[model samples]
Each structure stands twice: as structure tokens, then as C-alpha cells.
Target chain A: MATKTKPNGKSEKNQPQSTRLWLMFPPKLITRPIVWELGQKFPLVTNVRQASVTDEIGLVSLELSGSRGDIKAAIKWMEKLGIKVEPVEINVIES
Target chain B: MDKQTGFMKALKCRECGREYPLAATHVCEFDFGPLEVAYDYDRIKASMTRSAIQSRSKNMWRYRELLPVAGEPTVGCEVGFTPLIKADRLAKRLGIRELWIKNDAVNYPTLSFKDRVVSVALSRAKELGFTTVACASTGNLANSVAANAASAGLKAYVFIPSDLELGKVLNSLVYGANVVGIKGHYDEVNRLCAEIAGKYNWAFVNVNMRPYYAEGSKSMGFEIIEQLGWKIPQHTIVPMASGSLLTKIHKSYQEMTKLGLVSDAEYSVHGAQPAGCSPISVAQKAGLDFFKPVKPNTIAKSLAIGTPADGFYALKVMKETGGAADDVTDDEIRDGIKLLAECEGIFTETAGGVTVGVAKKLIASGKIPANDSAVLCITGNGLKTLDALVGHVGHTREIRPSLREFEALIEAETKSPTAA
Candidate 1:
């Protein structure tokens, strides 16, 4: 018998994918090295394409490359830490 | 089908160099970058001369070569060419050297600038053999899409946030379009529309058909330069919803300069937003390249897109043009509406208030320079947002229909110190 896999079997969960996202850091999280923390906490490569930091807020446009499942987990962790994550653009819509 | 593509070369990705056929598509497959209409400038320059434009009908179609349609526009051909008023009184009030108002509040069919976009989108949709059209709107775009689709005898489904002003809702419903009120914000509506657009073959004006739809906004900029005696203003303040208008206006200036229609001159494109939902303005104020999305909570519903699609490009335009961005509070928006109405006799909606208010702030801060001339793009009419001015624009004093009573009231008012 074959070993049981996850019910919602996304066999391609380990497939590598890359996406661009905008991360917004509130005042409390501005001093925290969130990008470094993100890399350490997940099996993913993070590249900061653009960033702006002030005393009150920090906005970053980051490109992340990793397995689909790892990227999903990393984003979840970032959200738990109060980092606002949004896709760079909706794939189907252009303004 | 080997249909005529007019002066258009193809739809080219703005990020990558990839090109796609002129079809109902928007984003690049690999990079997901937005595609834009690439035109043959040499062909356009040869045909679209100043005299040619002047001799054509007083409508946006006069700049036919620049628009993305494959043939003569069969929809909303009468739209655009709204007046550009030299607002002397408004200039004095704002302490600016010169001021002008590009009033799209009087645009044909629909009172907003969205009509210009819808006309091009529907015309292109028809040429592409689409029988159904749709859009995700924040009231104004829905109104324009519904009206234009009705006029073109095409089916339309416009999705909008449920909490929009009653007047705007009625305006769309009156056109007999399927107005779907989503129980969410404009961003949510847009997201759902993106999904629907992918699943259905219908022409979503701002989704799959965006490259053509967005180019329609350039007509407003073209009209501005033409009305200003074929010159670009030193400063142009445009209110930001998706920020598409600001970017397209900048593109129009560049296209005109490249085509030798307007002499290459220096100009700045400033952006405005209501403080309650000012993602782009906030990012701009912080001197950033990317904007953080916000949940909108402003009375200026028309300019209340939290996740502006063109926010990145809008920022780039402002930076390249040496422009600035700012936001005004809800109260300030109302004050802006009142100021323009009282000073320029132009009753504009809250988005116009955002433009006027930000213009005042920029002028006061010297970002726009009080000595420099500027033009305010008033994109919508005030009547659609009457709910915002219900108790704020002053109440009428009821009077009995009697000459003696009216005389007593007038005498009492004259005796009062605050009468003026």
C-alpha cells in the first residue's frame, strides 16, 4: 500500500515559484529586521527590490523565491507578526 | 481576421519587452507587467496635425490615431472636449499666478471623465466581437460603462461596492445595466471581477481590456494641451483613485512632445487623495517608490481605491516629473468642493474637492509655487454625491409667500452683523 498523502494533495507544493509582494511595516515593527527574520524562519530567498523607511512606517517591495508551500507558510508568519503583505499586482487585472 | 489596427503597432508589456497582438489582454504572462498600447508615432504624426484636429469634430475621437480602437469610434463619439475655464477668481483665492479647470464634470452621457474611457473600451469591445461588457467600478466608472453599453446596445454588468451613494446607484440602474452591488469594498469588487473576467469571455473594460481602456484617459490630457494653446501647464493636479489618470496624463504629454504636437517643456504632475484612504499620497509624502494599501473610509468614494492599480507607475511619474502628492481630510474635501463652487461656479464632486484641496495645500507649501501656473483636473460632477453635502452646504430658510414677510426677513438680515 502507498503511504497516505495530505487530503488536499497539492503534489506540486514543493514546486518552486517566485512572486513579488509589497510588505508594509507599522511603527512598532519598523525597527525589527523582519526581512532577515523572514529568511531565517522559512526556506526561501528574499530580495528587497525597493524599500523606504521612516521613523513611523516602513514600506518594502520584496521578491521571494521558494517552494509554494514554504512561501505560503512564510507569508502566514509575516502576517502573524503584523506585516501587511499584498501581491504586487493581480495577475488578471491591470489598472 | 486581419482587421485594420489603425495606427497601433501592438500591445507591449511595460515591464518586459514582450509584445502581444492587439487583443483583449492586459498583463504579461511571464512578468505580470501591465501591457500598454504601442502606436506608430511616425504614422500618427504625419496624419494627426494641429489643423487636422481643429477641423475634426469637437470630441475625443478627433485624436483618433492615439486611441486604441481599430477603426472609427462607434460608441460615445460625442464625448470629451469639455471647457477649460480660466479660473481667475479661483486663482486669486488660492494665491496662484494662474489657474485653469479642465472640467470633465460636463462630459457627455456621463458627468465624469470615465465616459472618455468607456467610449474607447466599448468601441474596442465591439470591434473585438464582444457582445457583453463589464467593469469593476466605484460608482463613476459603473455609471459610464452602463450608459455607454446601453447606447451601444451591448449587455453590461457593472460590479460596485454596496455602500455607494444612492444617486450614483440610481444613475447606473437607470441605464438598464446589471449593476451588481458587492457586499465589500471597491478593491474586493475589483478582485472578484478579475476572477470573473478570467472565467468568462465577456469584455471587462478595466481588466482584460485595460490597455485600450486606460488609453482613453489620454484624451483629457490632449484636450488640456490643446485648450492651453498647444502647451503643457507647469503643474497639473489630478485626484488619484487607481492613479491611472495621473500616469496616462503624463504619458499624453510625452506622446505629444514626441510627436511634435507640443514643444518639449517642463511640467510636474501632482497627485491628490483623501486622507482617509491615501495609500499613494502617503507613500509619495514619505518619498517612497511603493505604496502601502489602505482600507478606505472617506466621503470621496469615487477616489477611494485602497489598492490603486497604477500606484507604482503613478509614483514613478511624479518622481520623474518633479511632482508631489498630498491628501486632505474629509472636512477639507468638503471645503474644497465649496471653494470651487463658490469661486469658479463649478460644482464638483469630492474627487474634485481632493484636487482643489491638494492644489491649495501644494500652493501654500510652495511645492506648486504660487507664482507658477497650474491646471486642476475636475473629473466628476457634484450632483452624484449629494449625500456628502446634505447638511454641510447650508440649509434653505423657509419663507411664506408674502411680500411683507419677505421684506421683514430682508430687513432683519440687513440689520444683522453676519448678513454678509
Candidate 2:
């Protein structure tokens, strides 16, 4: 799902960026379509690079390309749903 | 680069294949893949012969060229070469034909395999002109870094979870190293260490110096091959925490085959973990390549890494080598510790218990056939984790210091139902 473009207004937080993350869904939320929800709720491109889902848990390696503010909000929303979100490999330390 | 860097060529990213200088750095910049020390295998093959390794001192340094060090090692020089025992009794008990225990429970400087990695990391840190070294440990690594750094005259700061065993905490405190206990788990401590490592120049062994520190585990694999008469075992079982040791052991086997140290043979490298925190094994059991993180809750504190750093690599190694992964309950872990102690006279830590327990399960389930020979890596000494076995082992029979009383106790024992 794509949002309508605002042609004139742009802020620093809305600057386009791409990021990767690892999302771990607990057993309770395993059946929920969280990735689909993440896409529908946020104006971002979500691509699942890899995923492993069992009855007990769901692990997804997702790549998101969108505005920085939108990505942050999506992550916060996932966290609020009791999903554990981590950077792909904690690259900030090495960077 | 005036000093000798042994036979190491450069640090190469495992994923992106980018090369970095041979320094205290870990991950690649682009893909965030872990950087590993790439070696000059041709030179290593020319010099690292069986006879050459046999002639060196009986320690982990015998495989010094393959280890990531510059010139001679200055720290933990006498770390490894722990015994590889032929565990016939244990084999019989587990219904396996042949079994061996690569017992690092009695490893030098500290009674754990962490000494091997600490030796390499601290020596490399010294070579890189660092005056202080540090690590984020569960328990064993802190004790090893504390003891090794003290011996090397380098200041050490070890961070651990506040709820570590008393023996491990005291082991570090006695070495005069600065031990910091975090209020959270090991992953938190490690995350904080990464942030601290970015700000300070101190060599955090598992963070900045991981590429070197991880190679130290290869020495254990090398020693096993040599101790087994220059032959690789058909099956080997290793415990998992961050899962680095299992992957490094597999790498060692491959390296030896490349260098013609051992004939290329088919072998499997299995992984074991506590059931409470077995993310990798759970994924492996489900035939999945990725693992979901779990909050650890087990008596096997040393193996309680919820988010194993090398979990992906460990899974890959197991899949490639036709190996399997399994975990055991806390009760099964205690039973494993007792089985090893009673049968083979080796008192290992909870990590070893996990290995033994999983081996038993694999053997019973025929994943590891009863007819094949296997080796179980016992990584730490039992004395370090006494809290796990306080009331589990059998109690001592108390009798007064009198022959009459002892005779009466013996007579009572003979009449007991268990004796019949």
C-alpha cells in the first residue's frame, strides 16, 4: 500500500532512508499478520529478506526503505505489539 | 607492521568478501558480517606439519601459526593441551561403542576453555600496543580475562551479569581485575561493552578483538585431532553459548584438511544447549536456518546466550556436515554431570553437562549411532559452578570415628533394601 505523495512539504525526519532489522515475534503473536500490518500502517516499502516461522515463534529479517521517521514509528509499533526488534547486526558499534 | 604477524594474511568479511587491515576490528562496514582472519594457507601448509606440531611445547601454542598472534605470545603461554581421555566406561554407560572426552575442565590458568581465547586475545591486544583489555562475559570468560590480564600486567575490566555464581565471581575478584556486574543479562552487558568499546581504545576482546579472540577456540579442535593420533573423529559434540566454539571447531577441521594435516574425512559437528535457552537448537530441530531469540532461564548459566552471535554460522556448519543440534533440561543436565563424574571421573561445568546430556539423547535416538566413535568436548571445570549441584548429588554417609560404629553402619547398609 502506498500513500499519496505530498509534493511540497518535506522535513529532515522525512528524508528517505533504507534500513534492515530482525524481528522476533513471540508465540502469542505468531499467527498475526504483523508484517502486512506494518506495511499498511506505515508509508514504507517492506521487503522480507528472510523468514522462519514455526508454531512457537516467528523470525523475520526485513529490509525497509522509506522516510526515517516512518521506519522509526513502524519499529515502535512492532515493539508495542510485544515483538522484539533489533538492528540487523548492531553495526553502529563498528561504524 | 614491523612486528611479525605470523602467517595471517588479512581480516576478510565472511559475507561481502571485503578485506580490512589486521587490527582489533570485528565486523565489515557494508554488510555487518563478522570479519575473520584470513590466513596464508600455502605458507602454513609448507611449515605446519605433524612432526613440526609434535616438536613444539605441549600447549595450545603448538598451533601458533594458525592462531592470530604477532611474534611470540606473551600471555597465557601455557594455556591448553588438556587431556583427551578414552572414556570407555562412559561409552558403555551411554550405550555407545567408543567415546572420548576432550576435557578442558582442567585447562590451565583457569579451569575452562575461555583461557584459550583469552590467551590469544590478550597477546594480540599487547601486540597492538594496548595497555588495557576487557570483555563482556557470562562467568568463565571474566575469570579467564581477569587471571590472564593480571599475569600479562595489563589492566582488565570484565563485565558480567550480577547474578553469577559465587565461585566465578570470587575467581575474578581474587585476580585483582576490575569486575563490573551489570543489573541485566549477558546480552545487555555485551551491548554495553560494544558501546563502551566504540568510545574507549581498550581492546574489548569479544567486541573489537573478536576476530582474533574467536580463533583461539580452533586450538581445542587441533588438539583433539592430534590427541586422537592425527585422525578426526566421526562425530564431535560441542556446547553452545554464543555458538562460536562449534563454528571455530568446524573451521579448524577444514583448515587441517586444507593444510594436509589430516586426510579429508567426513565428520559431523553437533551442538548442545540448555533447553531453557536453546534458540539455535530449536531452529535446527525445526529445520530452520534462522533462530528466534529467547530469554534464558537455566542452571547452565554459561550456555545461556539467548541471541548467539554465531548462531547462523553454527547452523550452517551443522547442516553442511550432516550434524544435528539438541538441548537438555536442567534435571537432565544434572544427570549428565553425574554420569560423567561417576563413569569417567571428570567433573565438568553445566556446559559440559549439556554436551553430555545431548550426546546421550542423540545416541539413544540413533542420531549418533551406537556403533560409531564420538568425542564430547567438556569445556569447563565443575568447581566453578557448584551452585548447580548443591543438593542434587548424593549426600555423604556420616559415621563416628570408631570401628564399632563403622562396623554397625556397614551391617545396616548390608541389610538395606538398596543393597539387595
Candidate 3:
């Protein structure tokens, strides 16, 4: 459950920055309450950024960010839950 | 760039008039009323002329001298210059003298008028040295924020109600933005974004960055007047959601008159909303001074904010302008969408349908005069909300590919006319 800290040593001036990721799912995957199930994997997650389901898109994007390794593994585990993950590129990262 | 001549001294609260340093703050601490970027009118009046503006590019940034942002624009360089079409056929059908369609549906990249606002927000965010940009949106806004942010090389986090349409989801995700679907309604999603905005140093476009963001919508009003050869419409019908666009249009018209760019004339502003979730229209109908929030339930999901942030101001503007607010049924919304597309070849989403539908209702009810020119603001493209119209249209004729099949179809079509 320990988070992986990057050895890049950019700066500790603020908190270790984490980029939020968006994951979408099909309706059947969401009907089984799989998004919350994915949330269970990231025990150290500072927050479940967002989650939702609609008629037009079925299950919409859910954003989460916190510990690096915890977020990566939680996302990988979400694939098992039938969720599709897309890495949202950030142009500028700030604490 | 000489900031003193372009931007006003500072942004001031609409209610208290308390001034704040020109950062991105929107709300006032004393009354919670939203603040607006006030400009030095005399300076603009002296500099801005119809010929001066017309000589520039067709984009919204053409009014850069009047916009709030100080430096170079970082987004939506090609966003504005949308077509302002004359709806002659639609005018005859609706019994109006002159009607125009502000076709913002084809706005670049994301295809919603929100691109106008996001373009300003992202430009200011970069100028402030912020690394991340984010927002709480219904659907079109998320698409715009994600796409514009991606194009500007900024990380974007877009929050939305989980029940958004598929096209919008794909639009945002394709831009590689961190799109979040909150489990609650749009208001809840907006609240969560506000909380996150306080905790993080990110630029939340409609939140902390709203003062500059809302200013972007003024271009629509500016474009309409300029396109009409520097004459203001006597009546304008705008869709009501956040109410920012409606109020901003009103502001632009007034500024034009003040600057002597247009002749002084009395303008009436009307607002439209779906009956399913019409807090502002309901308040206006009841002749109430304040809007009472209601849980939204409508196909026009884009305008389904039960407690709109600017509902009060919207009501006040309608009353002051001697304008009326009206709502249309869901069936009418679909009809409005079809009516616009069929008449003017403009495909708008449900919000646009609400505007057109209510415009019809208002004209029939004698709220809008037949002699006045009316412009309907179509904010988003129909493709974003195609599911709302699925199965509501189309013909089903089980006929073989032959002259006999066609004859039979014509005979059957005459025998049983489908209800439109």
C-alpha cells in the first residue's frame, strides 16, 4: 500500500504533485457499482476527484489523484473492474 | 501593453461596488453578489468606433481593447467569427418581422460558445503563471475546457454530472483531460470544484477565474451589433442557464450605445428556459423578485441548473428591460430543434430549442411585438445532444425498392399522416 515516490527530486517546496486521470465505463460495468469498487483499491487516495453516469454516455469520466503508485495501481485494478482509463495530459503541474 | 487604457481600474462587485485587485475572484465577500470587470468607459468611448472594430479580424479577440485580459490571447484565436444568418423562412413561420440566428454551434474545436469563455480563462491562467486549468461543466463546457487546455499545453481537470451524453464524454477524453463525473447533479459537481479550487492552486475557469471568463460572452453581443451595421436590435431572445450570456449581451448593447458606436435606442431583453427545470422563468412568470430553486428535471440538461448562480440577476434584467421570461414543454423543445434546422438549416441542441420554442410562445402570447427584430442565441451544436432526439423523428415505411413500393408508400402516407 506504500506509494512510489519518483526519484527525480524536482522539488519538495510543496506537496508531491499528482496528475488527475479520467476513466470512463460502460453502463453494465457501472450498474454493478464498479467505480466505487475501483475507489476501494486506493486506500491512500486523497480524493475521488469525480464520478457519474448518464443516458447519452452511459458512465462518464471519473478523476482521481493522490499518491503516484497508489493511483497507477488503482487505475490498473479498475481495468479489471471493466473501466477504461485515459491519461489526461497536464500542460502545467502545480501544488 | 498599456493596461490603464484598456482595462478598467479594477473589477468591482455588482451589488456593493467594493473593488478588488484584478485577479480572477468573482463573488463579493459582503453580499455574495457576483462582481464584473468594470472598464473606463470614457477611454473606450474615445477609442472604440464601428469602423475601428469592423476593420479588425472577425474573431472575438477583435474586441481585445474592450475585453478584460491584458496580455496576448492564448486560446480561441479562431473561435469567434461565427455566422450570423438571416432566418427569413423562420421569421415568416414564427410571425416575426426580422429574425436572426447567432449560430455559435459551429464554434471551433469543441463546437459550443463555451470556447469563448475557456479561451479567455486559459489565456489569463497562463499569464498568471498557473500550470493547471479546470472547471465544473454540464457537457459542452467540459469539452471546451479540455480541448482548449490541451491545445494550449495545460493540464485540464473537467468535472461534470455523471449522466452527460456520450459525444461529450468522447470530446473531453479525446483531448486527454482529467474528466470527472460527479455522482450528483451539476450544482453538486460545481460545489465540489469550488472546494477543490480552494485547496489547489489550479485555475477553475468558471469559479475563481469567472470574472475574466464571463467577459468572453460579451463578444456575441458585440458581434451581433457590428454585424447589423452598428445597430442594436430592439429585442433579443437569449437562452437562460447560468444567465451570464444573457446579462453579458445586455451589457454589450449598453456599452455600444454609450460609446456612440450605435444610436441610442430602447432594447428589450427576453429570456427562455425549459418548463421542466425553469427556476428563472418560473420566478419571472410568478412576478416574484427572487428566484426559488427547484430540482431540475428536463431534456435540456445543459440548462437544468435548478438553482442557477445568476438567476436573480437574470430576473432583474428581464424586469428592467421590460422583457418577459417564458418556458416551453419538452415536446415543444424537440419541435423547436426541428423548426430551426428545417427552416434555417441550423442544428442546435436542446438549449437552442428552448430559446426558439419560447420565442414562439412569447410572440404568440403577445409578449414579443411582431414589429421588433429578434435574435435567438444558439449556443451548442445538436451533435453533442443527439440522444435527446433519437426516435423523435424519421419515417418508417416498409416498402420494396420499386415504383410499386413508392406508390404504396405514398398511398399509405396519405392514408395515415404521422403526427409531427
Candidate 4:
């Protein structure tokens, strides 16, 4: 649906219900299965678009599909765990 | 673009909080701020060491941990690792204790430092799944892209200002690229390429893939430090075109120290530009953070970036390092080319002349410490810009194949054999 609920507590123009975020995990969090946690913890559809991981850190480009409120909550939850969560302007690759 | 540089975090906006997936996109969708590749330096440091780097190939790709690419490099993989010559003659002329030349004039493939960026750009484009690559350049970049893309088997479309030298034009076309000669300066051509990049699926290296392309210049810095016995030079001078190389070299120094590969020795980074289009130099001398763009009208067409994209960052690095910027005239540029050639036997192009000429001024003016070792970056080969030497260099004498005439000419010049 085009209409979406306000998560920032401000009324805004309707944004897409499905979106993506670029998640950066610090060295301390690299060993955790965050992708599994993302799906188990949130009601949103979690798609791991890209992941580059090493012993020091992990970065994931993730796409989520769900209601506006659920997508916002998913990102908020990730940020609470010391993960940097920011929206991703995607590439046309794999399209 | 590839799967290997997994240390690269998401593309973050330079001005805003916007972030982007590591893609071909450059500008932030929200505020139009440029997107730069973010890396987990901690991860890179964990994966890198002086011995680890020394064990790898001798080319630029050996610093794969720091470059933005994720997977194996697939373009111009053998480029970089040019010689760093110690210039005792040039240093003595400028009254300096020591001087070194980072001679990218002999860079692999296209004989310029542009080969370094082109190698990374084309490799990133392939990693991003771009079937075609394009760029707007003056001469060196066009030649580099064409050559690297041809070797990589990717379609290339290189656009350059129509008035480039004949040698550069021929060099690009010989690489089997589709060369488009636009009727404008490099800045205008670059502006047009920025528009074209958004419309087409093709990658415009300096336009859309700039963050990755710019990272390649850091290898020059890496090589300089590594070749200097894993030590940072007290002072280094780099030529400024779009200002990316200077900024990247400074970043390389900082990153090296951060990684514990080099000591945290204090070093200064100087910038060189031609007087005709010396925006960064002008800004530096005036103590201004920003620079006014100028129309490029110098023989050093390669360093004639009027509206430099990385000028702000370049100026910041200069200020932070306590280094200064200076410019040289077209006449001085020619003299510099000849000076290096006659003294060191290295025939550098106009851009190299700009660098050496500015170094001379900086040393003579006591801007750079006369007692410390200085490294000047010579960026291109003189053969590529031969037109710059048409009236500048001269043939001293003409002799016929007659023994009598040869003896008479030798006597006229040298007075007598013993006095000769």
C-alpha cells in the first residue's frame, strides 16, 4: 500500500512499505548471527542483499519488506545493539 | 563492487546522514552530497602488515585490503610499482639536502599515474556488473581507460576535449575504444559525463565510480612509503588536477601510521599547480578554505582542472600537515621539463614540469625545509604531451657527415682538443 504510518512521530508523505538499510557491525559484534536475529526479531521480511564479513567487522546490505511501522522497528532494534543502521539507496544490479 | 573488499562499509554521504549500498551511485539522494566508500579500518589493519603486503605482488593490487574492491581485480592488474628515483642533481639545484621523484611518468600501460586510477575504476566497474565503462578526461585518463578497458574486455567510451594533443588522441584510439571528441574544456566534458552517467547503465569512472577510482591514488602513497624503507618522507609534493591524488596520498600516510606500518613521524604534504589554473594554490596562499574556479589556459593540460572536485579535502590536508601550495608559470613548466631531462634524464610531461617547477619555487622560497628530504610526484611522460616542447627545447647544432667539417665544428665549439 502507498499509505504508511509515521514512525518519526511526524506526519509525512507516504513512502514505500519495502526498503533497505546498510548495516555496519563493529568488531565486537562480528561473530553474532545478526542476519538470523534480524528475521527472528522483526516481523519484516529480511533479505540479505550483500554481506562482507571478516574477523574484525561485518557489513550487510539488507532489504526489508513489511508495514512501515515494522520496518522502522527492525532498524531501531539493530541500532540498539551497537550496529550502525542507515537507509540504502540501492544499485540497479540484480534488477 | 566485488565480494573481496568486504571491509568496505556502506557508502556514506559526506554532508548528510544519508547512506547508500555499495553501488554505482555517487551522490546522496537526499542532499546531493557526494557518497564516499566507508571502510572498517580495524578489519583492514587486522588483515594487513608490512610483511603481508611485502609478500604480495609488487603492483598496486597488493594493497587490496585498503582498496574498495571486494573480489579479485580483473583489469590492468599488472599496473603500478613505478620507480622512485633519487634526484641529487635537481635537489642540489634547488639547494635542498635530499630529493626523490615519484616517477609515475613511466607508469605501466599508458605511461602516467592515471593508469593507477583507471585500473581500479575498470576493476570496480566489472565488479559492479557494468558491461560498459566511460569517462570524460583531458588526455591521460582517456588513454588509461581505453587501454585498461581493452585489456579487461569491457566496452569503453572515452570522451575528451577536442583540442587535446595528437599523441594522446592517437594513444586512446589505438586501444580500440570509442573516443568522442567533445567541443569544450575538460570541466565541461566532465559535467556532461555526469549527466550521461545517470541516464545509462554504463559506468563513468570519474563520475559515478569516483570513490573507488580515487582510492587507487592511495597506492602511490603506499608505494612511496614502502619504497622509502617503510618510512614517511618529511615532505612530499604532489601535482593537483582534480586534487584527488594529493588528498589520497595524505590519507595513505595517515592510514600507514594508523596501521602501525610506519612511525607516527610528522610529515607535510605540498600541492603543485600551474598558475593559469591554480585554484588550490591561490586558496592556500590567501589562507582561504575554498577556492575560486578558473578557466584552464596552461600547457599542463593534465593538471588543468579548473573546478577541482577534491579541492576542499586537498586544502584541508595541506593545512592539517602544515604544508603549503604553490604554482608555476607556463614558461617555468617548460624549464622544469628540460631541467629534469638534462639533469636526471627523465623526460616528464607538463604535469611533471608543474610539480618540479613548484618544488623549485618552494625550496628556493624557504617554504619547504631546505635540509629535509622532499619527494616530488612526476605524473606523466613527456612523449604524451610533445606539443608543449615545440619551441621550448632546441637542437643545438647541425653537422654534416664530413670529417673536415666535423673537426672544424668541434674546434669552433670546444676551442681545442685539450681545451675541449
Error of 4 at B320 (Å): 0.5
Task: For residues B1-420, write the lDDT of model 2, one tens digit per residue.
Answer: 225677899999998799999998886766567899999888888888999999999999999989998688999999999999999999999999999999999999889998999899999999999999987766788889999999999999877678866766788889999988778634344445655776699998887888998999999999999999999999999999878999999999999889999999999999999999999999899998878788889999888767777898999999999999999999999999999999999999899999999999999999999999999999999988888999998678887899999888789888894752
lDDT of 4 at B190: 46
Q: Which stretches of candidate 3 lie over 4 Å from their true place?
A: A1-95, B1-6, B163-165, B184-188, B396-404, B407-420
DockQ of each: 0.12, 0.09, 0.03, 0.02
The 10-residue segment of model 4 chain B with minimum total lDDT is B185-194
Off by more than 4 A, model 1: A1-95, B1-3, B163-165, B184-188, B417-420
* Model 4 / residue B214 / CA error / Å: 0.5
Taking the tens digit of each residue's C-alpha lDDT, what string does model 4 give over B310-392?
78789999999999999999999999999999889999999999998999999989989798999999988998888889966
Go through the candidates in order and give the clash count of each.
0, 0, 9, 4
Q: How are the candidates ranked when ordered by TM-score, highest leading?
A: 2, 1, 4, 3
The TM-score that candidate 2 achieves is: 0.86
Residue B54, candidate 4: alpha-carbon lDDT: 93
- List runs of model 2 lying over 4 Å from the truth: A1-78, A86-95, B1-4, B184-188, B417-420
Give the per-residue lDDT of model 3 (tens digit) for B33-136: 46788887776766677677778877998888678777668777888878889999999999999999999999887788888888988888887788899987
TM-score of each: 0.85, 0.86, 0.79, 0.79
What lDDT is reached at residue B215 by model 4? 87
Error of 3 at B135 (Å): 0.7
C-alpha DockQ for predicted model 1? 0.12
Model with the higher lDDT, candidate 2 or 3: 2
lDDT of 4: 0.81
